[model samples]
Target chain A: MRYSGFQVIKEALTGHKGWKPVWRDPEPQSHYDIIIIGGGGHGLATAYYLAKEFGEKKIAVLEKGWIGGGNVGRNTTIIRSNYLLDGNEPFYEMSLKLWEGLEQDFNYNAMVSQRGILNLIHSDAQRDAFTRRGNAMMLNGADAEMLSTEQILDRYPFLNVNDARFPIKGGLAQHRGGTVRHDAVAWGYARGADMRGVDIIQNCEVTGFRLENGKCLGVETSRGFIGANKVGCAVAGSSSRLMSKADMQLPMESHVLQAFVSEGLKPVIPGVITFGAGHFYCSQSDKGGLVFGGDLDGYNSYAQRGNMPVVEDVCESGMALMPMLGRARLLRMWGGIMDMSMDGSPIIDKTHIDGLYFNGGWCYGGFKATPASGFCFAHLLSRDAPHPNATEFRFDRFSRGLMIDEKGMGNQPNLH
Target chain B: MIINHPLLGPRDAAEFTYLGDASLINRPDWQSETAAQDFYEYGYLRSNPAGIHRELWFHEAGDRSWLVVTRNTVTHEISNVEMARDVARTQGRSK
Candidate 1:
């Protein structure tokens, strides 16, 4: 798990290595000016940005578990901004930009390798859709390349190469898109923020909140009560539960997403690849293991355990796409709860409550959006207004039919 | 054969369904059964179950958590077609 810079970069190129935490707080703090109720990537990123942007110290990130213990630590770390939806496109593009400059910005090695992500096209319809998406990326100054079947095979000789069921007609490759160390992102932001006087309270769960005159005064945690001028709930899985205490209902649902890793072998996959026809996606880890994941567990459950059907489905897709992986033994599998929004996008907006802010509903692709989401959420929290790109991601959009329904899958809780 | 259930579409139309303990719909009446037989003889149910078989389905249970259905075409044999809830419940148990 612990990777050096060279190993991290190399593993990132192959989609193989993950970040091992290098720092931990020796003592936990009791209070802060701002109490963020999750230690995932978003919470840590928000803390880092809050300290960096507002110079507001005494910020405490209270987590029921360790840093990166939530979806931040358990995600397919493929980073890209190839969004076609209006509201999400620009915001994700900003995240991609931050990914490009992350190492220099944080002075921490995130191992953000721009190895390119290829969204394979299975048919002419898919190709046309990808064309529109590629054009949009180009218009937004993001790098994208449309490739033919020959080009795909030439670049990736290890693929099955041909199959009538799901032919590899072509694909859209974002040259600037790739994978990163998911845990390192959380730690990097946490370390950077901690150095700026933010208190990261691990193993400290926020049990409830204290509201005074329609405003969030502070929170009551397992450790004790802590007062804060502003409180942001960045807890991805527990967003609705926390918000419900304030008589607010988020257009959010908590669903489980599962990921798996195959036993280590010599690296074969060179970049992150997604099968548009199937739910499977994969990138080789730094240690030569195949790291991959599939769609969310179709049913609702707070339990972080996934069933065999999805594992079988994803593995079958992987085997069909890469026949060589048939012999690769799956070493382990894990699941994390995701706050899937109705629109499959995040909600970075202030609630009707005066001091209560929210940054959640990341669905499954939150790892890549961490930096930008935090930056935008921090801006909103500080200014009490929406960020430029996130203006349409308001909490009230659902009521006004302004939902950003990406993937053309309406704002259904189970669709994402 | 395409077995058409009331709640669910044709059998093939269903991605997968759950089999349950009891039926939700009653058997067809005499006239409807005769018509169904005629349709089945004409390759309606023979080719696609959706043409003749009337299946009882319980929506809102299973993997997709929609419904349970039962369909029959020839002898009118009814059987449940839904993901086993116990299996899902067992699978959902935390490790």
Candidate 2:
């Protein structure tokens, strides 16, 4: 059912009974042309692009639990293309563009708000680095503006302008960078894929890959054995665990990252703001709650909960940046497992096994890279070639010492 | 989270630095035939299990001793704590 303002008004007048389910809850089929593992944002988007754009048939997206129960729903929802490296800027810029027209394309109200994102500059060294980063962003055709301290103060009056240790010097603002309604992204893509005859099978966990010689035949799932000509694994934090069944250990670790939200209040934060001295990044959600998060718990764990040390550190950083947050009552917090890659970048490439592709190692930034990750993974799965934008995200890059080390952190998954 | 140090009874987790899986201590020979592949696998791949995980933690703020802690990843429950030097020696490693 196509939705529009007219349909909304009509449904409102008719007691809202004409609305339909966003996506079908389908049973797993015995065979499919392509099978996608993990029904998160990337997996659903891959299936959506495969069916709607690539015109692929007999596609199935297998989920262990419900869709959007993974990192897609457990994020701060900020999206931006303000990156320094050439290996990352273009891909993320493409994702930002996709987010721009996503609602209209998927026919879902995803609430893509390009309110802007500001990365505050503290020290002179940080200003220099942010200047280089802004230039790099502009070189990649992404919007970037270096804002003065006065301009930043004019925008965010609640910030600490002259703290004893770290003073806000300037900022790098991307006018197109902002947050999206994260859950709507999953629903929209799932609906789009399902409308295109793609089967979205929930409660179907892939136990092992059906490997024959060098090629993958299908997958062994909780439901049963399902045959597929090609299998794409887009599982995020569980990449290593899942690939271990195939005797392939991934170059990533599962680390839990926590996020928090404050009780609903009047809208004060106009855009996403990130601290320069610390890891605190925050934005006001549409529901008026202040959503924020900080660094990882700094350990390897699959547990979707974090300890108090990191939580205390995050709140400390928040207080350092904005003292007004000290009074806001904390509503709740949650954690999501991140596939922290060795170089702090993602890996979207085919594995040593033929007909078996892998898409993961997104770390904590997977939420922002959802669209491009899916589109590029779909391009790779369909054509058996890396997308031009994702040419550097190969699994063999680590062995060849050709890593896209965005943060210059070497081989430390948790740090990434 | 608190790590029960072998020397010190219990230490706050904030005082220690994490170095990930204990398998990292098994450093392969540099002059081996498949040194490149071995180093690649050694430096990159990991058995990031969801259950009991044996990992290394350095007491940076205390005795500066490297310790191996066997803990459950799911429940964050610590079961065993031993000096990494002893664990490495038992696994046939010496300076």
Candidate 3:
């Protein structure tokens, strides 16, 4: 059922019992026109767009577990498109735009907050770099502004602007970039796809791909062999493991990236603020918890838990940027397996095996890229061609020396 | 996490810096005919298995030596450790 203000008031008047499950729990079908693997944000969004926008039928999204169980629910929930490169800016800007209209388009409350994001500048080089990045964002039709130290201080008075080691000189602000209710995004997309006659199958693990003669026919799952005319794998964290079953080695590794939430407190952080001199970014949740995260654990792993070194490093950076945060008690911490691509960017393209498509290698930035990744991936699966905004996310970019190294960190996956 | 360094005994994992798969030591020959393909595979492709992985770790905050640590990716359990120099020598790299 479509939720609305009228429905809410009527349900409230009628003792609040008119709500239903967001999406149906359907069993896997034998065959489908298109099957999307991994029912995370990307997969569910792919199904939603495939049906709603592309007008495709007989679509299915297969999930190994419950929805919003992976990185979709494990991220710090920040979204921004303040990128510097041509290969990335337009695509992420498209994603930010989609996020703007997502809640209304999907008929769900995703809590899309455009409460601005500030990337703090500590050094002259970083300022120059972020200045170029701001120009690039504006050039790509996204909103950007350079905030002086006084302006930043006016907003975040608690920020340690005059720290001895890393002084905050200025900041690059994206007024359109902010956090969203990440789990509701999954639920909204799932409900939207379900409403559009797309099947979302849960608790079905794809054991292997049904490949023959250099073409994929279907997948061998725990339930049974489910045939599909086209299969798009959007499993970012386990991309390597899943693709290996098809005998295709991806140019990426999996690393554990951790996120943390502190005990609920007064709303201290107005929006998302990232420490430029270090690897820490934070946003205050609506419930008053301080959400933050930092660099990866810097090792290849399929595990969803990280070691303590990175956690200590993250807290140190947070303390460096905002010393007042030292008094806040951390409520909990969690990790997500990031499909860290070699060039530190995502790939959305067709694989060598016919009828088989791959969409992964998102590194730790998959949350922000969710909408565009799914839309472009659906476009590719339906049209068999990369979207104009995503033309650079190809499998052969690395071999062809067309790497979209956004952070300019070379082939180091962990650094990215 | 603790890495039992071959030369320095048990050491905290914080003392080390990670590079990546130990296979990187076997760099492809630049002068080979199929160098392009070989280098592409060598530089990008990864096993990234969920089980035990032999990875290179440099003891940046310790003895300043590289070690090949055979660790389980799923459980974060370290099984074996050896000097990367010895492993490279055994893989037939000569100066």
Q: Which candidate is the best by lDDT?
A: 3
By lDDT: ranked, best first: 3, 2, 1
Please give the TM-score that candidate 3 achieves against the real structure.
0.99
lDDT of 1 by residue, A49-135 (tens): 989986777788888888888888888789999988778888999999998988888878888988889989999999999999999
Give residue A371's error in model 3 in angstroms: 0.9
Error of 1 at A375 (Å): 0.6
Better of 1 and 2 by DockQ: 2
What would the per-residue lDDT of candidate 2 be over residues A62-89, giving only the tens digit for each residue? Answer: 9999999999999999999998898889
Let me know the DockQ for model 3: 0.91
Report the Cα lDDT for candidate 3.
Answer: 0.94
Task: Tell me the TM-score of candidate 1's A chain.
Answer: 0.93
* A16-48 per-residue lDDT for model 3 (tens digits): 888888778888889999999999999999999
Clashes of each: 27, 0, 0
Runs in model 3 with CA error above 4 Å? none
Over all chains combined, what TM-score does candidate 1 have?
0.79
Pairs that collide, model 3: none
